[model samples]
Target: MSDNWVVQNLQDILNRWNSTLSDIWTLITMSPENFQGGAIWRIVLNIHGALQAIGYSLLVLFFLVGVVKTCGTFVEMKRPEQVFRIFIRFAIAKGVITYGMELMLALLSIVQGVISTIMNSAGFGTPQDTVLPQEIIDAVEDCGFVESIPLWAITMIGGLLVTVLCFIMIFSVYGRFFRLYMYTAIAPIPLSSFAGSPTQSVGISFLKSYAAVCLEGAIIVLACVIFSVFASSPPTVNPDAAAATMVWNYIAELAFNMLILVGTVKMADRVVKEMMGL
Candidate 1:
């Protein structure tokens, strides 16, 4: 709201940058079950419920296949010890199918705990706001008509880039939530693979991948915490420089920092997978 349009333009872009960071912070802490006031989660739960039958049917097939492959002869399978072992495997598989979603949620909750711990240890309640330096603003205010032209162009370009980066960052965070929902909705089909000894690797890999997905929140939170520390110290403005140079330096550096944070968040899944050896 500055009388100086250049100042106003810069302020608007900075505001958007701060708002997007705040939104990303909020999302990393929220659970899938609580997302969108639970509307999306309701649909996900219904789909998961419908898939339970399919998962249960697949579970029996895997268990029988496992028994056939693991036993060399029909007589070997008839032994009391073999029957008990097979019965145990079937019970475990059924239990896994029955509670697979809950298991995934529990894993997610653990990751949430990790995210909370990282934020607490880092002493950041939220990402710090990156603001336009006052020196730049005062300098911009002092620019005469001729000088203000370039200042206007600089602000316009910087503002557009900032605005674009803000949306890109927030959209990346939203995409993380969508991925979580997709993994949850189709969890049972992969989870049923646990019924077979030979095929259990499929279930193990599925669970590990889900854990990695949940761990993405932790990695993203850490990235935000690191960025918050960086934002606490804004880009230094040279008071002696031209108003345009100062603004350009500030905007370029500020935009670069924002890009760093956004890039880390966008690559959070890959980072977690690498760390977890997924």
Candidate 2:
């Protein structure tokens, strides 16, 4: 089922790309007089903007996965050695997933940008423009190119799935290690008596810190996705207008991600200190 969904999604993306390319070709061929004006520059600018969007999307994904792994390590410290091994394995798996997702997101962003640019160049109103047929506008909005409820929902679901998968994989790997930790002399102390042993306290603190970091990271990613969706909306334009709007939108997204990273780190530090009774 999952494989089928993946295949279907890929097909949908390809179809959208083909449709977009066709529109661009039609526009250029229909009126060669307009092709050399702002239309050409708009196309170029939109493509560049789309690439930038993809770049930032991947960066966000990479940071998110890192945050997840760091938190997993801290959280599993109750069975230190066992958890450590699990963390290592999970990290490897996560790296692969993150890289692939990043690549796909980038490609999708570029396709979206190209399609949107073609539409605008052909005198289509911005996706949100009330002048456009409501149904057509809505369709474009829901297509994951613009920030619509469906797109946001998909992103939320995807994040949750990834987080749940990570949790499961980590637990599975640590299950065996946990048995060994239990047999060893330095098993993690119970949470009830966590304050008595410095080592145990350190573990507890680390776990708390990790949880806080994960929470912050999750929030940041959510915010970025939301902001990106809104930012990616096509601006109302005639062929003569500059295409720099897309570039600005990309810059705004990068700024948002950076803010999230800084905030997550700060929150983690505070949570760790509090957990350790410091």
**Whole-model lDDT per candidate:** 0.87, 0.36
Over 1-278, each residue of candidate 1 has an lDDT whose tens digit, in order, gives: 57988898888888888888788889999988788999999999999999999999999899989998999899997799988988898888889889988888898888899999998899888888877777887899999999999988988999888888878878878888998898899988888888889889999998888888888888888888888777778678889999989989888888787789888988988898888788
Stretches off by above 4 angstroms in model 1 are none
How high is the lDDT of residue 112 in model 2? 41
> Residue 87 of model 2: what lDDT?
56
Q: Candidate 2: list runs displaced more than 4 Å.
A: 1-204, 213-217, 235-239, 242-278
Each candidate structure's TM-score, on Cα atoms with residue i matched to residue i, is 0.96, 0.22
Model 2 over residues 139-227: C-alpha lDDT tens digits? 33334433333433443444344344334323422332232222121211122122222223443553344333223322323322343
Clashing pairs in 2: none
* Residue 101, candidate 1: C-alpha displacement in angstroms: 1.8
Model 1, residue 123: distance off in Å is: 1.2
What lDDT score goes with residue 194 in model 1? 87
Model 2: worst 10 consecutive residues (lDDT sum): 183-192
